[model samples]
Target: MTVTFPHKTLPWLLIAPQLLVTLIFFLWPAGQAIEQAFYQEDAFGLSREFVALENFIELLQDPYYYNSIGVTLVFSMAVAVSGLSIALVLATMADRIIRGQMVYQTLLIWPYAVAPALAGVLWWILFDPAQGPIALWLEYMGIEWDHFVNGGDAMILVVIAATWKQISYNFLFFLAGLQAIPRSLIEAAAIDGAGPVRRFWDIVFPLLSPTAFFLLVMNIVYAFFETFGVIDATTAGGPGQSTKILVYKVYEDGFVGLDLGGSAAQSVILMMIVGLMTVVQFRFIERKVQY
Candidate 1:
């Protein structure tokens, strides 16, 4: 006897719970935030008036808002590129090794397991002025180390912390992509007198584009949003708001400053920027992908 299955109803049944959760948790909150962005609020988070676009206009006119936008862009790009480059290099190197490969892969990817907050604390321990090990070492070595006095130091520390935390994730994806390539293709390229560098650029690189693209998008999102914990722990939006990215500013405005409407406006701006970036990236890369 053969069994019959109602495929359409089963699929919907499986997806119903997920759809309901997303609507309740994600869609509802997003709609509320969008609504809040346009409304004025009182001290108790009560809606006082319909401000209708005023918050958005204020966000655009404010210099601090513009500065936060610039900081967010710079931090996101720096972290994404540095993390991807380092991860790609490490993944390629690991792909060439033969012995104890799993051990090395495990060790290299272990940092991805660490929470961003924990990683931020570790960086704080390393870079904290007057108290950190690096600070003490610099003092002993007669080298002045002052992150607080230097804006560049703060930016560099944030970039380094973000990149370090994300590199392992990118490394794992790249390694998987590298391993998926057929050895026969590489052998053929080598037989046709393709050098290692030539093979990499012409063959391996193109094949790995999908993986690179995936990581690029994920890295941008992570750097933009998830790195807030790291930034908060390390600098708390800094000695002079030097390290305050858009999301950090949003958090500061809503939670610390008690300006929920303003924070919602900032959040709306971030969502717009992220949405634009994603659309532009997809349009740019979709054409380049070879089927």
Candidate 2:
């Protein structure tokens, strides 16, 4: 059955608010960034000169910019894989609980409610080399733990913080997907003498592929963009820029370094990278998804 709106104007009116918001918040800012990418502006923004692709050329040649790109790729992949993997495990465990499921799920989800910056701070405090219990314990175990000075440690800290924040979100979706799977299929697989691991690999996981793929894309996007707060709070791209992802580099250059044109160019490039990633995922990766 086809449901038609009585008036075309009404249909437009219903979407007007969303369209206006997108235009004002997203499209307008994107347009401004694209324009700024081509212009060289001073710190005071009092004078500007169009420089076409100079900012982009400088960035391409700068090794630090390339470092940031590599860091972002590693960070995004780590966060997405670890977050989804851990969440799947938690969701599977939670799915088997016959009691206290609400409490368990609630505790699992509580991390997601924490603000990103706050979560970063929480992890920072928990891993503080001087006083944090975890750091102290690691020290007791004869392993040095210090993110403040070690670049590898700093990267690990940011990755852990980012992944921890995303796990709850992945958990919610994984739980929903797990619940949506028919119980009869599992029962039949069990009757056929399949073990839990065999059933999961052969039947359950295939059905969950769609959910996993969606979470993969979301987690990558989250790690790329939403992790700025976590990095800013914890490492600030410090320990010799080991943890500085592309998004944080954009902020660092534009706001902190006062390189307006370069920062705008970075932002534009980041936008293009994300757009291309989304396209590639849907075009190629989605083929393996079951539903």
TM-score of each: 0.91, 0.96
Q: Model 2 has how many clashing residue pairs?
A: 0
lDDT (Cα, tens digit) per residue for candidate 2, span 219-269 = 999999999999999899998879989999999889999999999999999
Candidate 2, which segments miss by more than 4 Å at Cα?
A: 1-10
Clashing pairs in 2: none
Output the number of the TM-score-best candidate. Answer: 2
Residue-wise C-alpha lDDT for candidate 1, range 195-273, written one tens digit per residue: 9999999999999999999899999999999999898888887768679999888888898898888889888888989
In order, what lDDT does every prediction score? 0.89, 0.95
- Give the lowest summed-lDDT range of ten residues in model 1: 40-49
Per-model tally of clashing residue pairs: 0, 0
